[model samples]
Target: MGDKPIKQYRKSRPRAEELYSRALESLAGGVGHDLRRGHPLPLYISRAAGSRKWDEDGREYIDYGMGNAALLLGHAPPEVCRAMGDALELGFHFGNDHPMQLEWAELIQKLVPCAERMRFVNSGSEGSMLALRVARAFTGKTRVLRFEGHFSGWHDGVGKGAMIPFDKPVSAGIPPAVLDTIEVIPADLDSVAEVLEKDRDIAAVMLEPSGASWGTGPLTVAFNEGLRDLTRNHGVLLVYDEVITGFRYAPGGYQEYAGITPDLSFHGKIVAGGMPGGVLAGRADIMEVFDYTGDAHRDRYERVHHLGTFNANPVSTAAGIATLKRVATGLPHERANRLARQLRQGMDSILREEGVAGYAYGDVSIFHVYLEAFPGSGASDRERLVTRDVNVLKGIPAPVVSAFQKMLLARGIDLVSYTGGVTSSAHTDEDIALTLDAFGDVIRALVRERVIATLK
Candidate 1:
């Protein structure tokens, strides 16, 4: 629960520590992604398959991160791997349109509710950036409205309002002018109406349809439905950033799950079957901004001019096709979601029995651990906790969360962001039971070390 678990973790992964020391000379921050900048040292994974990953030191963990929620079919599923292999034998990059790209788009269009027309991009950030550009071009508006704590991506335009201390700079290099174009507000229909009422130049209203932080700040379906109505009345475009929830929520994502079709929606993660690809899709007229016409004047000035070297590359398209074909049947969703429900219920039971002041909650295959609640709010405050209050959901003490992470990691379980994780069809009943046992141990240890407060 404290330094003891960290010590054990460090002791068990000497090879990873050595690799980290070597990595520090080349990799900035001694890691590739900011999230991998681990507590004591980042884990160096050697291989992964199914629901487990083996570290460089040959330590196996029941992986709940699932390649950052991209591995809906689990790591290197045979079908996806075989597809990628066959694609590799054919060609890698064609530098021109390929038949696989058409198949990929057809599959996505078949599934996603809002994807009438689409463009391929390299990442979720690129998808969002392109969606905003299309919205502005189609609507002839300048600014965008975003809900607080909803993560779009790490691009300059959407980065500012994602983190807390909302007024402060998210990154140093972002221009003040870029920040000015984004209007941040709470996830309330009234606040949204107020903004639309005041700002006539607003281009679009964008958010994570499952709420902020991939359901960490959970949003109700009613709110999303209301927002859709409000945006329609105000003549503003509605965009859903479905990077995490793309196929994980369902074949079509939260849009299909909630039955709320966005004007534009951007997706990554499972869309490409864990490959590095994303889709920017919505209404055909809006997407026509990217289409080329015969007239030189119109083509030169009016077209969006979107370009990417690896957009819908053959290998990624193959993987996406394989994954989506399976996801279409709804079996994977059933398995993953059932396991997630068990894990959530088990964690909540552990918290209650241990007298801890927290709960486990999320939608579909996603789960979050709020290990510490606000002062004076006991474990019974489930109603208040699920109110989608960003401050309260993300307000846990850093030290407490860190301890919780270390304790769980020491027990050979890996969570996404130290708060929660996404489930995959690869996970079994045994995996869930073992995860609960590890979680129970971690919770008890946290209480023993006074890292998390206990309800009286």
Candidate 2:
């Protein structure tokens, strides 16, 4: 390894550097998403296939980002591509409805217990917005209670409390009125009950069931069950934001895995087979808010207004149907989970051997590596595996994490974020082996350079 790894990284990706220089002239902030912004430059890829991708500079990476946790079957699965091709021959978009949309909805309804009725949207953000609207309209209530760090989407209703200073908005343009209607609380049933007791205007309590940032702030099974009962008792709708967990956790997502159904749920990512689509699903009574009555007056006043140019376009629906057919067999989850387990165990071993103060943990197919400066004792690994303490899990210095990511990129392993990512059925044992080797090298190099502190 080079003494200055960042300099080596910058030298290795000349092509990406040139592209980024050009991108700065046109693209906002030289990147599409805020998280994609990397130090030096972000790696731009030319193509991807099952379990792997090639960068603009023709470097190969064993990809764990997996299209931002959307590709459970991996990149461009033949079945999904074939279905999209057939759909293209038929048509791309019709201003009218089609049979495939119904088939797609039926597939979701069959898998998800909460999906009694559904409305298609373009993204998870839209689904979250719709869920809040439907909850407010049905319950005749204006407020929503969301737990700290539980991400729903980038919309105004969910923009607050995604980060620290939980009272402030993540973005600037959101109005104060929007923030007023949303309440942020810790992920505790007692706190929830207190809010429910005092606030009768709360229409819904919505959260990411796997916990904030896809299990960084993990929620326990007991907590989920208690929240479901509490919401029911308080006459408030419980909503699940299953954008990352749907279809990947199991055939029916976390609701089925936990066996605790919510009154409403929003799904994205795998729900549309890595395509640009999302679904807002819930009880029939709550979903009837979207129905059209024959009387113009009743329809205008009572029903929710939802319109989108690409809600369930033929191509996305075709991909959804094809992906769901494969997911229903329950084979994909098994392989993904097994491979993830192998990776986590290997990573934990590496941390121990290197004397790094960190551990590997996650649920189902997801995995995370937590690096800490302190290694205090008292709890077993299982007891502290999934924590509710946000600071402990999220407190790694940004520069260190960014350097770690660059080193991993140099070694041809791409994680979704700095810490970890999801596994796909396409990932192999060989991939896990190579990833662990790369991870060990990265940790050793970081410690040697004092980028990360080893155990004292």
Candidate 3:
């Protein structure tokens, strides 16, 4: 045998790899959700505390993904766990009228100004679906307008064009006929005006106030105010899908951040404290549709059916209540913004030093890193063209991006598979420093390996 020795990974991720292989035998795509399937095998997490997680192979990582931006208070928070544990001792699931569920609803009403009344559901998808139903019933219209990049949910109705090619069905199972009921519009005010003028059957305009799916790009405050005016003028409902941005943005949610109140709002993610829960909240008059008061005419009230077996399970409600209560006073936005600025600034500096044609940007906690062909373009036309060209570059076949992610993984840093990462309150200044150091090293390695011509 030769005297040379085989190099081994400093941290073993073999158990996670093995688990994914085994999972593929039974589960489609080896995950409960399609988003969980990232390249080079998804890491199986054994346990997580604060901003760190241990993979099945016992490798520790600083988690910036943060449960797809759900872990606002970080993983396995003590308050959330304690509350849930107490609730579990009492009972997990009950009928729709559980006390903890009501408590959470009340808490949401207090935090979000527009939520005069609220209803609980099992997921953001369910909350959005139900909110749309309420909107249609209240507006007496059949169609709903949705934004190009925002994710409403996976249901057949609203899941038509979430994050895929514009105007194309994101998945195969949904029928083409359903697309007609959903009016697709870009974030631009001109597009909204054209759609609203053309489509009279539009019941509501539902969009993310902060646009989470498209790399956390925020809508201009002027655009949001214009939308509020337009929806009011047209007598249509404005539904803000605050599922991803709810508690992460601020205690009052993105509505407060944008200074525009919608007719209805759907919340999940942070509201559930990383548990399975969702809420639809809005004006009392509009929410009255879901009220089952026998005083109303049977036909009018019963026309809209809102029912779910596990709508407000006690365990999830308890976790949510604890999370919300903690965040109501804590300063997640400040901490997240600080970290985001540090990370973005560090990444941009590295890109500049390496002569890489790319940019990193985000708001508060969420951030995106995009590699492109053009380094700088100021004009709107040039910017738009650059964006389109950069998208095409991403679509083209390349191994450098995958290698970059694996390299980060090996160095104990985690990010969203696609193009972004989320920072949490649990991440210390040290964690931020460590992540920036790793990113710099990775860029240098990529350049050395000829992954790209130069960072500059």
Q: Which candidate gets the maximum TM-score versus the true structure?
A: 1
Per-residue error (Å), model 3, residue 409? 1.8
Q: Single out the weakest 10-residue window by summed lDDT for candidate 3.
A: 1-10
lDDT of 1 by residue, 263-347 (tens): 9999998999999999999999888898778989989987788889999999999998999999999999999999999999999
Model 3 lDDT tens row, 297-393:
8646545787788888888889999999977875877887788888888887886777665666777788776654222232222223224222242
TM-score of 2: 0.95
lDDT of 2 by residue, 1-456 (tens): 345965777787899889989999999899998878877788798999999999999999999999889899999999999999999999899977899999999999999999999999988889999999999989999999998877799999997877776668989899999999999998889999999999999999999998878887788888999999999999999999999988888899999999989999999989899999999999998999988879899799878989998889899999899999999999999999999999999998988788776778888999988775333332334334445676567666776777788889889998888588989999999999999999999999887777775565
User: After superposing candidate 3, which stretches have Cα over 4 Å from the reference?
Assistant: 1-12, 212-217, 293-302, 373-401, 448-456
Please give each candidate's TM-score: 0.97, 0.95, 0.90
How many Å off is the CA of 29 in candidate 3? 2.1
Candidate 2 weakest ten by summed lDDT: 374-383
Model 3 gets an lDDT of 0.77
Question: Which whole-number lDDT from 0 to 100 does residue 146 have in model 2?
Answer: 92
For model 2, the superposed segments whose C-alpha errors exceed 4 Å read 1-8, 374-386
Error of 2 at 207 (Å): 0.4
